[model samples]
Target: MRSKIEQIRMSKKNTADSGIDIIESPEALASQISRAEIFFIKYKKALIGVAIAIVAIVLAFAAYRFYIDSQESTAQSALSNVVYAMENDSLSQALNGSGGNEGLLAIADNYPGTDASNLAHLYAGIALIKQGKFDDAIDHLKSFSSSDLLVQGRAYALTGDAYMEKNQPEEAISYYKKAADYKSNEFFTPVYLMKLGIAQEKAKQPKDAIASYGKIIEEYPLSAEVTNAKKYKGLLEGEVGE
Candidate 1:
């Protein structure tokens, strides 16, 4: 009995020495609440300032988003009129704006970060190409960017065309390769590959030209360009054999 009593006393003493209270007293809980209240009182102004700063930041971001949306809407509206002019073959009006509508160049310049601005660069580049302004066409085409696979590929091909017009077959070959390789698909890749082969041929690279045409014949056999590719590949192979 004494031993068992001693064991109970040892357990209680060990628990106390460990400083771990399983049941917190009312006074301890009240003391904790008081400390928390004091802390809040001491930093009340700072905490309020932080909250106000966060709210201001949120409001500022919202305002900026709204402003951008409005700008995009205006730009899209303006760009549509210019596109209509282009479709109508009114190149001068499309570029220079005959009436109140801003031309493609103005839209591109006025709205730098908007999607409409980016598309304006593309339309302007194509217009410049039509005007035989090869250098300007290349510059505007290079400035344009898009996530759409078809548009981006077309831009690359247009850049190649501009370079080819400038009598820079090597530069044209590089851009044609980019167009052919980027997001290769059945519809567009064959067209770009044909352009690549032509550029390679002009650059005195018959072997590379043959390979490009072979790719179209083998990989994109159903494409309209496949027949042209086969003809060009045969021609290049004959020239290479000599």
Candidate 2:
């Protein structure tokens, strides 16, 4: 009897160590099921409310996304209709609309928070520049934003041009530097660097202007700006030496 009792204890110990739970009787199993049912009954209302809340939140987010997508689509369509005026060089019509078609300025104003609205700002700024509205061009260009490095750089360069036209060499230098350094490439960077060098020269920063031109000669030798860069750099270096 003593040996049998020891063996039973040892079996229980091994089962516990192995994490193998054994239900001793049907009554115990039934009791556990009953307790689980009781737990469900006690929290049924709260559990249902939580599930409903999760579903409502998901639906609300989906509806909001759909609304935003619809608004963007409408704005893009409006932009497509009006961009022909810009292409045709009808500056006034492009900014103020012709007939029933909306203009770039109108699209920009009406479709706030849309990609098309941002592009409208760019178009309007360019039109303003062509019309000799330098201050207005700067304002619209400042409002325009882009993720594309090339386009954004071009906008910066254009802003520099506006400032230069206004005889603000310091402001022109700042924007030209941004255009030159923004994801610099051989093709466009040389152009921007040339602009920067000119602005720096006008600002009486001969050394800085020479360095800007030197970058074009050394880094973008194949660019069209290379010839001009060399000429400018030589002139500035001679001036500094004198």
Candidate 3:
């Protein structure tokens, strides 16, 4: 279990350090956030079961791994603080620590092999991205996994966003494509497509960008991203003389 978890972390770091944004529309940010909450709630219930399995793997089956149940709860408590900081945009405090509670780095480091540590990696990655630590964000985000498609898929897109910020649009496009096509959900799929389209445009693949945008329009017509998708696709189409 320890080796397996490390392998996932290493994989993300290797792809990101070796080679390697947001919602599209102004009006959609609010809607996107609400929908994202719904997604999180839906998937979180699923992840609880996965977390149980992970606990079993780390404790009962795995001989090499070690952590206590209380530690897991403690790590989770600290992680909740980190999430609070992240939600409130207190990036520095979230990444490091504040007066009372612990931060993500500590929880993740101290509670290695636990599911809460994995979640710490996810929240830490997001906090790092907000602090402009793109490469580090990729490393942290890659360590995370959940049985929930929404969470895991967003992790892919988050790394893509990190790559995009680093100005490596091709890597960004790759991850964004992974995110856009991942699981095919109603909430995040269109948003991921918008991200993919923008990355395609950045990489000077206008045709591909238009295709991604068109996917949003055709598949997720009611999505908030669809409006911006049409807007950007029209501009790209005109530029391509079509």
Q: Summarize candidate 2's per-residue lDDT along 1-242 as a digit string, tens digits.
A: 56988999998898785443336556657778899899989999999999999999999999978876887898898888778888899889989887888888888888787889899999988999999999999999999988796999999999999999999999999999999989998779999999999999999999999999999999999999999999989988898893
TM-score of 1: 0.78
Best-to-worst order by TM-score is 1, 2, 3
Q: Which run of 10 residues does model 1 get worst, by summed lDDT?
A: 17-26
Error of 2 at 88 (Å): 1.4
Candidate 2 yields a Cα-based lDDT of 0.90
Q: After best superposition, candidate 1 residue 98: deviation in angstroms?
A: 1.6
Residues 207-242, candidate 1, lDDT per residue (tens digit)? 988989999989988999988888888877887793
What C-alpha lDDT values do all the predictions have? Answer: 0.90, 0.90, 0.86
Off by over 4 Å in 2: 1-61
State the displacement of the C-alpha of residue 28, model 1, in Å, after optimal TM-score superposition: 5.9
TM-score of each: 0.78, 0.77, 0.68
